[model samples]
Target: MRVAKQFTPEVLLSAPRRGPAVPSPDGSLILYTQSAHSFDDNKTLKEVRLMAVESGASEQLADDDKVHDAQWIPGTRTDIIYLKSGDKGTTQIWIADGADPAKDHYVAAEYDAPISALKVKALADGSVAFVVAGLVGPDGGLFNDKTDEKKSTGRIFDDYHVRVWNELYKAQKYALWYSTLINAHGKWGVAGELQNAIRGTTLEAPYGMYDVADPGDSFDISEKGITFIAEDTAPSSPEYSGISHVYYVPLTSFTAAPTVRPRAIVMGISETKAFYANVRFSPDGSKIAFLHSSYDSPSDVRLYMGHTSSFGAYDVHRMIFGKRPRLPPKAFEFAGDSDSLLITTEDCGRVKLSHLELRHDAEATSLVESGVVTAFYPLQEGNYERLLVTSNNIVDSSLWQIVDVSMTTQARVISSATKHGAKYGLSHGMVSEFWYEGVNDAVVHSFIIKPSNFDETKKYPWILLPHGGPVSSWLDSWSTRWNMALWAQQGYVLVAPNIAGSTGYGVDFTARIYRQWGGAPYQDLVNLMEYLKPLPYLDHSRAIVAGASYGGYMVSWMFGQDMIKKFACAIWHDGIFNLPVFMLQSDATGGGPEFGGAPFLWSNGEEMEKWNPARPELLRNWKHAPPTLIIHSEKDYRCPITEGLAAFNTLQAQGVKSRFLTFSDECHWVLNPENSMIWHQTVFEWVEKHIGGKEARNF
Candidate 1:
């Protein structure tokens, strides 16, 4: 009577994946980061540790492979700073000091000045400035292969370039630079000679950039300078109008040569186009917080809160807008004595916690409700402002809890770190979450997992899934990918739902699936398969359903619907199947907002035509088209690989039964570990030869 284990993807690659954690403003050291999979360098291996939030003890600091911008050093307690690599692979910023890891150094004394994301602050007099985000070539080395082959001999990308996920856009911009920390008297040195300050002129070589494009956890630090979020692209205004403004620069004029120009101050109203992001700034620097998003809306995000020492004379208010969806704007921050702010989004399918107040402009309340959040902070401990969480649910994986809310609302688990993950000597599997109703009655939110040898008088077999940000959800998270506990150890019973455009359900249920792509979350997955046929344990004729990228555009819009006979088969990684050919090979930019951008038709792009599932009269509503499997990769430029070759040439010209795989050096996610064990052994051998699973692939 005791067997609970089996979940797979090789038990989510044997578990070692913790978070960005950081802590220590004198809260007794935390600094985290971990990773593990190394098999003779078939990669994963990254370290950077240092626990001890009061003796849960841990040490090892940096195996040097992505300590994803570690931090701390703000009024120290064992310094930290991170980001390594140097000579040629460029990125440097180093710093160590857990009381002498041989007193480490390198903030940039030269050595190909490439740097990337560093932000530190301290200074009221005892100095310590840092503020990075780098790149400098023609010998300062931005990956010098002779300055990347003499700046590509002639590279010229004009017409407003912006590529996404395929990477690099205008030499991937990234500017601002500075350094000061160097303290020879107390020990620990190097960081100083770097003061380029945005530019001294490479003559705008590779199109301007001073901020607002990645230095993610976007900018801040203000004793009167450095505020970030850029894009004015000056050529006489109105060039790349994805708006963005909030700029500033003053830290006592950065101590040395001609480094000033950076003043703008949170703009956007070029007659209502707008767009901005995460900004921050309130820890006594006098108030700020950001995220605006508006380009002609389908629920455009808002949340403002202003006053920034009146830099642009903003008085501002709108504490939140149209319906949530905007946290992780650099993990938000500020509770306690800044009077509440901390957030963490995606609410409903979980990953919750909220705060707001900021002297009560009200709205934004919920404070931690159930799991999936992958990291958090805002801890004043003792007199308690607590909330240092890190979540995980659906058969728990990440743990580090603690909610506390000062004189009340507690929550515990201080560290469940490394509890020997990955084992399934059989039994565990049961997640569930339910609630139905959709299309205007809304309420949605679904999920179910079941199978650890369950038996509520048997019925079983199910799959469904959907998520992929048709605005993202179906998260109660823990993943190697789409894992409802590794697909309920194969004895099926999965389902996901959160439909009607998803994203923690709000900006009009996530912009109503952008252009109603396949309308109302495919009729909320056919009213959750007619309410999972009276859930007496869900069998739905041994169902099947799979997804990826808009759930592979809803399994190629469920092969043009009639609910594709409630799925007897279907999967579609990297999918968009066709909405004007994914808005013309999308890297985002599909014309018409009266040239303001992202507009194309009727009050809603290309005029929603009964939700174009690439309409050719929706294949005469496909009499019965389920059987399919089309995964794809070969460097997916956001939904390319010609959307799994046009959903495998329309299920082989509608003769239906399909299969197409592909991977050729992956992208758009298939994170190699033997290409994710051959993508979960080709979707569990095409769900055990067509969805009636028997669990024989020895996991």
Candidate 2:
């Protein structure tokens, strides 16, 4: 029997796929982002594509190079709107409503400033409202204002200065400014900067940005109005108190700023109790639903139902009765009815769809059981009940499928957008789930990727991967960064365990590592390896451990421990070596809670050594540490360069064989294609050198 070739970094990374399938208003057509890699330019070329639902056909939208937030102009499949760069990198919204390929209905409108954020709502009256984020340039720009407000000389900072990730530090505030397409006299004019802000916000509560993993436009729209959540915090202060209030304002009465600034419905007395977000208006726009977490993390997010009388006050009701979901609330789409929603969330190790029925008052039910649903894009209900969804398990990458909303049968394939696996002759690596009891009888789940051509007769090196987050989970999905298939291609079995601190488990399970970062979770990894040591197919002597971010912190701590020496080598990227330096240097928005309390020291004023890997308490463990490889970038503000530098120096001073890999341009992630290639190639070479295996062929 012959074995098929498995995936490599280049093969997996260059796969062509339609990004985030978005169905049209009438559900006839679907549009999505398409990206292709350019070897000459060393960049990814992005374009918008439209797909016909009936026939699996696709056509690329021309004249779009760097499209952002491209969505079908609601109500019609003919029109599409997206943001792109103009002169000097200033983004403006462009519209394409075309019936011909050669002659396109293209319009590019500028409001005289860089469009930092934009959201378009297709109104029933044939006009569309645009919520844009600009720095409020000179002469009031658009919206018909004539005020010559003098420009401030320089940015004045009292406390927080010079840095806020994503947002620039400046005097002019970034507010959600409204604009409209005015064709009253058969001419389109960019309007609505002078019109009062639909929902004005300060710098602290970034109106247009996302602190979590979400799309660009933070607000969602329906036929009736819009809904968004913002917290009231000091504008210049660099802190998030996690206090958010949901607001709903109608399109007609949004003439002035703060047209309706209502207080939070049933807000807790303590500001730090909960953080609210993912607000949505039901299909009919009569009901609203939003998610809130007791803590800043996504563990305890719960769905709260409410009713709003046409953008007036909201009577919010918390859902009381359903089996509590294992993960946070996500993928909220009204199920064509007033009572149900089509949503998907993390369950065990996959993101699966669920039908939530909001009962009369307090009770709710999970109508459908969760399954292997990677992603879901809600579509308008046709005669047949269906939706555009991306479904996959550990053995397959997610591809677009039209699943029955009724769940009566298997899903039908809608499109084959990703073809790189076939193009490069890549075979699917086998995957399976493993479970073990860890620290206090808690059941920890893990996913394993066996070698492409697996046989029980041969033993293989093990690659134990610890996920970062400390609050995130390892979901069953395709990844370009850490390719599981690529590792398996190198004849190594990949083991990724969702340890105690990982999300998807309940809130208490996630919070168990609050001040015990180096305690139980570390034991879970070691215990998992111990349980697997008896397996005939695993070569524990040649095993290696690797991680990034909090995973990096774990690796660094493991490197500092002499008692738990189970592996031959260790690797960490952007790890937190010194918690004290981490808290002060990194721009992690929320601070202090992970350490159990605020910054504290003994009477001598020494830094807190509880969770700091760089403390003297853990210094002796690195005396005979395994061959270590440290990877970090200089611009990584989230974890800071100081961490890697300190760890590398400590390893060298302690006489441990180590190598330090540094990148000048990358921030938290190595996103550039060429840089990514170098990252994979070098890291694998280091692993092979230490583990006594020959390097695998690079693509």
Question: Once model 2 is optimally superposed onto the true structure by TM-score, how far is the C-alpha of residue 670 displaced, in angstroms?
Answer: 0.5
Q: Compared with the true structure, what per-residue lDDT tens digits does model 1 show for residues 1-699?
A: 223355567656745777746567666667777886754556777787777776767877777674457777777667777767555555555667765554555463444545556677776766677666665554442433323545344556664444555544555444666666656766545544655554543222211233324455456776666666655443222223345555555556445533466555644355444556667777777766666655565244554555665664232333333233343222456664466676666667787767666543366676676766766775533223676678776665667766765427667666754342223432223776788887767778887877767788988778888888565677776666666766776677787888876767666667666556677788878877887787798777778888898777777777776777866777778888766556556555433232234433343444634455778767656437766778888777667788688768866886878889888878688877767877887888887787654556576
Candidate 2 minimal-lDDT segment of 10 residues: 139-148
For candidate 2, the TM-score is 0.87
- Candidate 1 local accuracy as lDDT? 0.63
Candidate 1: where is the Cα deviation over 4 Å?
1-19, 23-28, 31-54, 57-71, 78-118, 121-126, 130-396, 399-414, 417-450, 454-459, 464-483, 486-540, 544-549, 559-563, 566-616, 619-699
lDDT of 2 by residue, 1-699 (tens): 222354666755665645767777677777777776766667777777777878867787753575677766654545667777665445666666533334454455754445545666666677776665555433333321123345764555664434444332554544456656655453344554434343343422234243435523345565655566655545333334344566665655333344554334453335444567667777677766777665444356676656667333322323434453345665566676777776666667777676666663443334233325645665663322777876544444546777776777776677654332343344444678789988888889998888657898988888888898888788776667787767777778989999978876667777767666787788887688778878899888888899999999988888778633778888889888886657666665453355544443432123357666777768778776788889998777778888999999998999988999888888777877778888888888888888885555555
* Clash count (model 2, backbone only): 1
TM-score of each: 0.32, 0.87
Which ten contiguous residues of candidate 1 have the minimum total lDDT?
A: 201-210
Highest lDDT model number: 2
lDDT of 1 at 166: 55
